[model samples]
Target: MLFDLPDDAVLYTALLARDAAWEGRAYVGVTSTGVFCRMTCPARKPKRENCRFHETVAGCLEAGFRPCRRCHPLACGSGAEPSVAPLVAALEADPARRWSEDDVVARGFDPSTVRRAFKRQFGITFLEMARLRRLRESAGVLAKGGKVIEAQLDAGYDSPAAFRAAFAKLLGQAPAKFAEDALLRADWIDTPLGAMVAVSDRSALHLLEFSDRPALPSSLRHLLKASKGSLGLGRYAPTDQVEAELGAFFAGQNATFRTPLALEGSEFTRTVWQALVAIPAGETRAYADIAREIGRPSAVRAVARANGANRIALVVPCHRVIGSDGALTGYGGGLWRKRNLIELERGYARA
Candidate 1:
């Protein structure tokens, strides 16, 4: 789900008032200065015509505007939660360290408080974030033909069983289970937002999701079952195509994705996906709107369920769906990413 911003006139008024309500939801890019700032920035305001409002920092950057030095608009989302900032910094400082609840307590912070803060801001606990980072590193080593023991050490896991459990939690299988030659392959694709895991066969992409998504393990399990355990580590033709298209999309070069997709769902779900693709990049549709468009005007909830069940991420454009009230609802990729995607597409509309 994405935040629907008000018209420019109303947004300008909010900017003039330095409204705190719009601090993270809306930003104004100053055309004259070539910079973007949060609504609560204390710097002098620009004239109405010279101001351009966007819903995300990615939008500002795509439009060729640098972050304002005074406001530091980029930090408003990640650093706004005071309790989460220091922990994020520490994680960045030593990403490979095996973090634990005891370590948080030793840092003079309550473990529960830290957990809640991280969950509220990033949609994951601090320890979960650390574990995901370590696992991703380990996955990289395995992808490059490294041994399981080497990968475990690289991820900073002292116990083999602990490492296997953690890896299985994220991937739904142990590192050793992946075959050297398989029909369907999985690979990592880095994007502007984060790293995404892409699973594909020779002709079509089966799955594309953020590596840290909680639902990833279940999704992988389902995919493996469907593929009859013919899943391994490597890219297929579809993976390469999607990687390029995603790169272009984030770079603001092209919004269209032509990669072939192997959609695995019921007829109704597939219909919903078609309706989603018909939506223009810069616009959004509510569940009711999608239902009506799909010729099932009363199936709003069903449409929402199908949207959630979608496996291929941006290529299917599930992020283009929002609540009926224009509020961003639940997005599997995280609300922060949903906002960025919605705002980033506005550049496509302008182009």
Candidate 2:
């Protein structure tokens, strides 16, 4: 609600005028074409009736709209920018390639320029992005019941030990420990923001956190202990469903995640989490607001504590809460991600 476009008239005026002021802050989801574009998109304007104003690109995507190709909204600040696109494309086309700073220079791009572009667009260096791509490539195989050695080779790791160490560092478990038939399974999900880890049983998702979160390992360990160590690595129905819903969510569609969740927390914490789920997307509430909603008006600090304790990220909508002063608050996931999620939901998108 940052841009606060409550009326179609006002939104349409901005759209018709191609207001750059609303470019990232406002989006128009065109019903006829089933696509969303920034307010500054040069595509012919749709009728006001076919236009639905959204606060974030994610909001548009959640409403079942795709990004408009002409405007290329997702490319604005992404590593896919004109200067960096060729290198990004090359890396993506061969994700397992061992990328180095020297290799970038050899490819006729200045290493410093490439580094800055990637850092600005993806919040990661080009080499780091390459490494993550390799990990993702390998992890996908592991998630589908591939052997440890196979995954190691797939990721371009030189040896089993190296692969195991890297995989363990990222997932808190070595590749060999990932049993195909274990009761609970962990899967990797790629997103525009970064990678996420999803652990699920047959019927419900138990954990969802950004892979880089320092707390992820401990959280997964807790879930394993709670389930009596009946955990492994692979995909489940819930993981698959959530991934698909996440795809829609990132694409600017209204994706209602019907995937069931199974989280372990105190009764009070559970109540707070459910309250978070009740918060609508594209909107935010203060911790005090949540405390009041939960009928615990004096428990503002407790509400913030419970919010921080939430393990499920987007599904729980904990990011929808801000500080009482309207400033962004702490998120176990980087505050940058929190800000991005807020803007994404509010239709103020970045590349």
Candidate 3:
């Protein structure tokens, strides 16, 4: 409603007026400079045909445009210090020790800013986030190496009880409960989009869902029972591979997911999910069409339910499923993200 128009149209008008309100939502790429600028960029405007709009920095990069040094498209302003991306890296390397305000000052950062940044972005304070990150690492250790006590120490917990409680809180299982022989092994993989959790057995990936999917816990609970397996943090075949391929996918380079997955669902559910995968990138499908594709034309309601049950997001491609009237439906990640996903995919769109 800012300009009483659709996003693209509003963006076009904003571009025409060089509006400041539309800064983050839109970017303009000039083919001449081979660079992309923020909506508020003061650079001389090029011809409308020469100025292509993008939804994100990733989109501009994918389109082979470098970020303009003047615009600094990748920068974000949370309460975090202007120089704190490396803190995440440092915490990844050593998360056990109590990181004090003095320690943060030593790193040339305001500790409060650090705390706020972590909280704003991750919804958790820096110390709590470090604890969680370390705990996740410990879960991986127990899942694969068959060691519990070692995992506890590796997670930076001095007391085993503390580690066990944290593990139980995050994953329903204690570290000691992690089994190597279960039908499924849950693990974490980082992609360009974000961190994802993949559950797999020796043969196939039964569950490949993003860590942030609101339906993840429910999906895992259902899938775990179905697979006769326990869930914990760990990694397996194709999780790493999928992570790499997804990075490429997000960069708009190519869709190169070759990981074989163990699809889990009822016969009808399986059909709906398979059809979901068949949906090409940058395109969308109606719920009724999905039902029709499964040969259950009247099962649109059932198909939509199955779509909600889908574990994988971008991979299994549930984001492509829309309403019968082509409206975005209730996505677990929120409809705005669904819209962003569609636009991200359409960046490389071809006729």
Per-model TM-score, in order, reads: 0.70, 0.68, 0.62
Question: What would the per-residue lDDT of candidate 1 be over residues 241-336, giving only the tens digit for each residue?
Answer: 998898678656789999999999999999999899889999999999999988999998899999999999999999999999999989999998
lDDT of 2 by residue, 1-351 (tens): 323454567779988999788866777777667667888899898987567676655445334455677886545445455557777667646666667888888888888888887666645577876676577668767767788888888788877888888888877778786655688888766555556889999999989998888989888778767777677877789998998788667656663678899967898899999999988777899999999999999999999999998888899988999999999999988887788788777652222
Which has the greatest TM-score? 1
Write one digit per residue (lDDT tens) for candidate 3, span 1-351. 111224444566788787888766667767566667787776676776456566554444434454566655544332254545667556645656545577778888888888877655544566655554465557556756757888888778878898888666555556676655565677765433434677766666777665556667667767666756555456666666676676567556775467787677789888888899888887789998888777889998899999988877678888998877878889886676678678777865662
Q: After superposition, how far is residue 142 of candidate 2 from its true place, in Å?
A: 1.2
Please identify which of the two predictions, 1 or 3, would achieve the higher TM-score against the true structure.
1
Candidate 3 achieves a global lDDT of: 0.66
| C-alpha root-mean-square deviation, candidate 3 | 10.4
Q: Model 3 reaches what TM-score against the true structure?
A: 0.62
Greater lDDT among 1 and 2 belongs to 1
